[model samples]
Target: MCARIASPCVGLCSTTLGDSVCRGCQRTDDEISEWMALPAEQRDSRMVELDGLRERVAGRFLRIDDEARLEAQLKRHRIRFRPEQPPLSRAVELLRVGRDRIRDLQCYGLVPLEGAVGLTAAELHERLSARLLEEASRRRRALQACTDSHC
Candidate 1:
């Protein structure tokens, strides 16, 4: 779970169960374990990576109109989210916690974008989170490939 600090751990970490990608924050097991120990520069780099990933996936289905409203709703609902993350992440957090109950996206300052219509909040969250994970895995592989090639 996202803490008051810059860490993205959602507290419901599944990494301790031997999962590679944490079921809660979607971070890898290594990321969760090393986050606190990582240097500021490294943590900042990881935040940049997560922000980029959220933008790519969240932008596909949601748009933010009033970031303050999104922030308010997240706080009101006790949803965990990173202040360091992009505004779009607020909407993602809304879905993550209110998947079955979100009645009006407008209330959360979110506008349903392409591929979002015809899907319930639960469905959209499912798709978005799955896509986010897929994108992360793809980027990780690409990075590994480049590193392995000594590029």
Candidate 2:
């Protein structure tokens, strides 16, 4: 049996706030609305695309020292995450859900790197979230353009 594909919703959907791309999950507004009707394969494919972008952006700021430990921490703290998600990308979920509460990055099996240094957890989360939304929006527009042209 195929494993259930998890929705990326963080329960802080900015799409309701009129953003083209949700700052919470980074999904385009249309994707959010159509999520339930999307077939499993399409959901998985879209998840892979989202995970890839998350890892690309989050990797710029953090590194996973141990996936197992990170998973443990996430569960201990009750952070929502998909088991199928790349552990590195799960870092984004952690930052979003626990930004204000997280005190030490090392405890979560993450090492702050690059732009993450010298920033509070909230600050880091904001920067990462902003970048993710920006990229997702750009990608959505590109896809829309392609569709508009029948590419």
Candidate 3:
């Protein structure tokens, strides 16, 4: 009688922008590239390694339940010496920096920020759009200023 084959993975390999994984086995692109040359034992070992990595990734999410408590604590502490909000002129510069970081996150396919400091995918896109608008306005103002001086 033929033996039934064991399944390679769960449905957790949904994202594969930088990796390859079927339901049974998933690996980084570099690992997948060398998979054919690896001995079966080596492949098995890699699967074990991957399982550990997957668990770490899935378990590392920030706890949303604690967010409110943390915010409340900060508000109660009333940290002194808060600066006033910057004028509109400075918003562009701040947005530009934020957009750059967002782009880096998107390009890397993962935000490297610890905990909830990193923007979510939707938030990153929104920040980029806002930055683009800010940049356009800044350029327009600069051009108008230059024209006024020259004319």
Q: Show the lowest summed lDDT stretch of 10 residues, model 2.
A: 2-11
Candidate 3, clashing residue pairs? 8-24, 9-23, 9-24
Instruction: Summarize candidate 3's per-residue lDDT along 1-151 as a digit string, tens digits.
Output: 9543222333334236432333223343444456667777886665555444433332343222343332333344432211321112122222223333334332322323355356654453344444433443444466578888995
Q: Could you tell me which residue pairs clash in candidate 1?
A: 1-9, 1-10, 1-11
What is every candidate's alpha-carbon RMSD to the true fold? 3.3, 2.0, 21.3
In angstroms, the error of model 1 at 2 is: 19
Tens digit per residue, CA lDDT, model 2, 1-151: 9666578787989889889899888899999999988998898899999999999999889999988889998999888787689987889988888899988888889998976887888999988988898899899999999999999
Can you rank all candidates by TM-score, best first? Answer: 2, 1, 3
Better of 1 and 3 by lDDT: 1
Mind sharing the TM-score for model 1? 0.84
Residue 142's lDDT in candidate 2: 97
**Better-scoring candidate (TM-score), 2 or 3:** 2
TM-score each candidate: 0.84, 0.93, 0.27
**What residue runs in model 3 are displaced by over 4 Å at the alpha carbon?**
1-26, 62-151
Q: Candidate 1: where is the Cα deviation over 4 Å?
A: 1-5
Most accurate candidate by lDDT: 2
Model 2 error, position 115 (Å): 2.2
